[model samples]
Target chain A: MHEMALMGDILDIIMKDAESKGIKQFSRIDLIVGELSNAMPDALTMAFEIYKEQNAQLFTKDASLHIQFEEAISECIFCKTVYKPDFKISICPSCHMPSGKLISGETFQVLSYEGE
Target chain B: MEVKLNTNVLTNNNVAADYNRDLFHKTKTLVINVMSSPGAGKTTLLEETIKKLSKQYRIGVIEGDLATEKDADRIRQLGAKAVQINTHGGCHLDARMVVATLPEFDFEEIDILFIENVGNLVCPSGYDLGQNHKVAVLSVPEGNDKIPKYPQMFMRTELVLLNKVDLLPYLDFDVETAKEDLKGINPESTLLPLSAKTQEGMDSWYSWIDEAYQACLKQ
Candidate 1:
């Protein structure tokens, strides 16, 4: 019930499929997860499951669900260069700076979907 | 054969974070995420640092704690713009929270911003708070073994402030092994052992700030 409120925010934008056929059933979803965003995969999945039950009358028995994530990359706030760090890149490889304002990698986006 | 749906959950938040990033770049503000275990001298180091650099550069601070605005008040008292984000029960400050609070500070007047992350070593490291760098403090009382026990914090940091060194002689802390593990994981990291309370090695700490600040200017 609580998730419906939160999901309502994300769902409002997701339902604006003006060009494609209306979402008959959701097959999968693509998401961009910034390393800094606090999107717990477990919590979101549980939330989605609850939403599915709430609107159970709208879906088929075999409708599938898949979630994909994109790694968030940060750009240096000072140099205006993307902090293309190796997951192991500890500091700024270019300027030897310790940390910079995170430019990206704190995201939650639905890139595209294969529904209906 | 084709379905196109473009949506973003954190789009609004990301828009603000990007705007903040652009502001930092345009103004050449060096941002740092300062994190540590509770009582590890992060605030003490910051207080001492503000006293030294406040005259040369316009400094600001975003204090993130589970509760209390005491740290924010301390920064403001020291003559700096301060914003406090009480996560309430959350363990760390996320990018959204940081972005949401940017309007509270005058970014143009600020040359540097210290994000005093909640006194945590784990989950805080996992979240990005729009900081320029991640700086971690490990006080002697907390033991140097913290490097290996909390490898991610040490490994991700650009600088590691081994604070409370004045208490080294009174405790069983092993600086040698700590250095070895830290260097092994991140050899490129600059390590400065000092006492924030006693002001020991504050120069090295200042040197780091100057260096990072200069880099921002150059960029």
Candidate 2:
């Protein structure tokens, strides 16, 4: 899955940044994953565990991944009704139109990491 | 020590994509990234497209596959320059992969460049290859549930080429329902039904490309 590639990129970013900050080993990683971000959090956790196991030298024995799941929220442009969207393109319940513009739940980023 | 790094996981890919976008804009090349599920007739559509448009414009193609030069060879058979990028097992083509292949084509000599992305409905929708437009091909055989099931692909693409309309009479694919579902997911997207085999309704696709090429020159 692409989650492996996304996890690889996450590790690459942290490793490069951690080196510059004089961090020797990572203890934890915090990621903000949105429901509509195209990345599954469970898959990301599996990938992180695999990377942690393979690159034991860089991570602490108990190094873990913490994902903050963001719910997908959209606001209808026609009615201004806020609701949870099942998909990126959602129909507003109030307006019954496909005018809901996503206001949140598309974020996929590393919020922070603990090391050294 | 806790490092506060608010960074995107796809930052590197986005940076490379921006770089590729700059190059495409500078060269005035109308780049179209065509994506679809496996066996959705992407190559056949490209073959017909090249045949129709090559007389007036110099076209180049970048074919992406898990592991094959077959698509590139097909484009080459049409007498246009084509380069193949095999992802091995990678689900989709990233921006850096496209950057790696940029050296093979002289953009100045190419008026239009079509990037045929790996035939996957899921992974390819997430990555940006710095194309002027992203188009998805959905065949009638894929059924009506595809538009709703793969909203991300339809949401990101500006155009959806509904291929194999020639087979529509034999299948239960509802064109009206497909259009309605697409609208619910992405109202801005337009779906054009056509048969690459029969060459029916291909004129609209060519006109869209002509308009896109004209728009590219203005920018």
Alpha-carbon DockQ of candidate 1? 0.22
- Candidate chain B TM-scores, in order: 0.91, 0.99
Clashing pairs in 2: none
Residue-by-residue lDDT tens digits, candidate 1, B111-166 = 99999998888767655555678899988888766887775577678788899999
Give the candidate number with the greatest lDDT: 2
Q: On residues B44-65, what C-alpha lDDT tens digit does candidate 2 reach at each position?
A: 9999999999999999999999
> Which DockQ value does candidate 2 get?
0.74
Candidate 1 positional error at B170, Å: 2.3
List, residue by residue over A70-96, the lDDT tens digit for candidate 1: 455545545656665553333455665
What CA RMSD would you report for each candidate? 7.5, 1.0
Clashes of 1: 11
Query: Scoring each candidate complex against the real one, what DockQ results?
Result: 0.22, 0.74
